[model samples]
Target: MGVIKVLTGNYSASEGAALCRPDLIAAYPITPQSSVVEYLAGKVHNGVLDSNLVQVESEHSAMSVVEGAAYAGGRVFTATSAQGLALMYEPYFRMATLRLPMVMAIATREMTSPETIWSGQQDAMSVRDAGWIQMFCDDNQEITDMVIQAYKIAEDEGVLIPVNVCYDGFYSSHLTTGVDLPLQEEVDAFLPPVHFNHATLDPDHPISLDPMTPGNLLMKYRRSHLEAMKRVPEVVDRIDKEFGDKFGRYYGGMISEYRIEDAEIVIITVGGMTGAGMDAVDAARENGIKAGLVKLRFTRPFPAARVAKALEGKKAFAVIDRSVCFGWSCGPMYMETKASLADAADQYCHFSAIGGLGGADISTDMIYSTIQKLEDNKETKTELETQWYITE
Candidate 1:
């Protein structure tokens, strides 16, 4: 059975890893992400989790160790943050393209320039095209659950791609919250053991990995990776259904919609800020506004179809992103959402970007302001525009 406890988010992440029962864990500490490693370390030290806990010297070594373990036919896991993730970039990119099925928890923090260590999506965003299945989370519970689900999705036949389960630093990692820990038996039944076709150092089936590929062979591997990623949504839904049946918490596949039915305005968001956005929608509803929210938990394989369907008849939509696509006319999330809603242009669906970078606090007032802009546009505006919210 799953262990039940009032614990910090870091503990939940560790518990998730324990429940998955990884065969190997290699991690290096960085602020915000260190607690997750610490929790797993305790389990290893106490003999609760029988796994190879490698104390690597740096994030790069940490990822490299896990990559080696995974290539050796072992189920492996790891965690890191901003600079740590950046440091591990070389192996991370290869991990995904090679289809390693390794799972990682990345605590999102800002990239250093002026040298700050606060929370932001800049870390993960930096590797957007790294060929990994990235899933951003909204709360502690989701963080815990995604870790387990990520393993299942990555190891599935259709998608042997690595998965990145990302949650905000300090905001989701350090913050303590009440989260439901799934029953051990229930989770075990839902997730199966990792299967490896050909791994490095497998004496029984010795095979070369990342061999030099020339011409069409290189394109074929990239093609297969794309095909595998395409199957993530189906794999995700199947796992979520099983998770809900066992834990009573259903994360509606890649994106979860709240109060979109019979609504005219829909607010778009991803990660922890989504929770605040949903609450704001509820508050707006109490005042009789036809407002709703859609929290996108997954980003890598963007759910364009579902997004299009959700905004079919909506008059306006606003996408709140924690990261920006500076050269683009709007935030990355806004651009993705706008492209998804392209088919619904006949309904005059307007779009905008709000709140980004460095864990900026997003209040209900901010949500309300966006809704006001949408409602005000209901009567007069018909063109799409990218509006950035700046404090007066």
Candidate 2:
């Protein structure tokens, strides 16, 4: 039986990690993400979660500890935020390239420049190409569920890559909501013990791990890594169905479409903002506008095929990005979506709408307005300029 409990997103992640039974947890404190580790630490101290909780001095060291532990044949976990994630980028990439299956929860926050510690997808978006499989959650329930599913996805033999469960900082991280906590026995049945026949620091079978590689050998490793990433979508779909069959909750694999059927315009959104974007689509529908929404669940694999199929016959569409793409003059997600739909670019009118930066609220009105703009310019057949939903 599942337990119905009201919990914050951070707590939900902690609870999910506990149920997944990580053998080791190495984490350093950072805003928005600190509570997730803290809660796990508490569980460890109370004997509820029997795991090694390493109190590291910095986020970089924290990741390094997990990498070492994971290499030693232990299921490991960690949590981080914006700057913390950036600091750990070195080992973060190495962990993925090394083909270590581990789960990390990212309470996504804005990267510093003018310096702000608030909710933003900039943290995760910045490392989209770092070899880790990344998935964003729309709410606390999804956060909890995806954290559990992440372990399954990462440990799959065909896709032995690290998985990052990212949720908007201060938004999903701090927000409290009801979540259906799964039973421990059921979770254990769902996720078996992780077994990897790769390089390990086992004393019995000692061998070199990550030794210096020649260009030809390194290219082979890179090619194999790309091949593993290609298997993610199918594996994610299978696991999502299996989980939903047992838990009665199904998040559409890779991407989830809301009312795309019989729609002429669509709005693409990621993470927590998808809820508001869906509401705006509902409003547009009530007002006689055929608007739909595409919630991007996985961004790392890019979901190009799924995205293209969803927006296939739509007259116009706009991607809502919470993080900027620096020189692109659009959001990171917006650039990715545009690239994904490049083959079908001439089929629909498209534009980018960037907003919700530095934890700013992306109101429904702003989303609705974006939909309205797309509907208004459906026949323009010209690429529209980037729209910023911020007051000067």
Q: lDDT winner among the candidates? A: 2
* Cα-lDDT of candidate 2: 0.93
Location of the lowest summed lDDT over 10 successive residues in candidate 2: 340-349
Name model 2 segments beyond 4 Å from true: none
Residues 213-262, candidate 1, lDDT per residue (tens digit)? 89699899999888888888988999999888878889999899999998
What are the lDDT figures for the candidates, one per model? 0.84, 0.93
Give model 1 RMSD, 1 decimal: 1.9
User: Residue pairs in steric clash, candidate 1?
Assistant: 1-184, 2-182, 2-183, 2-184
Could you tell me which residue pairs clash in candidate 2?
Answer: none
C-alpha TM-scores of all predictions = 0.95, 0.99
Q: Where does model 1 exceed 4 Å of error?
A: 1-3, 203-206, 343-349, 379-385
Lowest summed lDDT across 10 adjacent residues in model 1 is found at 378-387
Q: What's the distance in Å from true for residue 37, model 1?
A: 0.4
Error of 1 at 117 (Å): 0.8
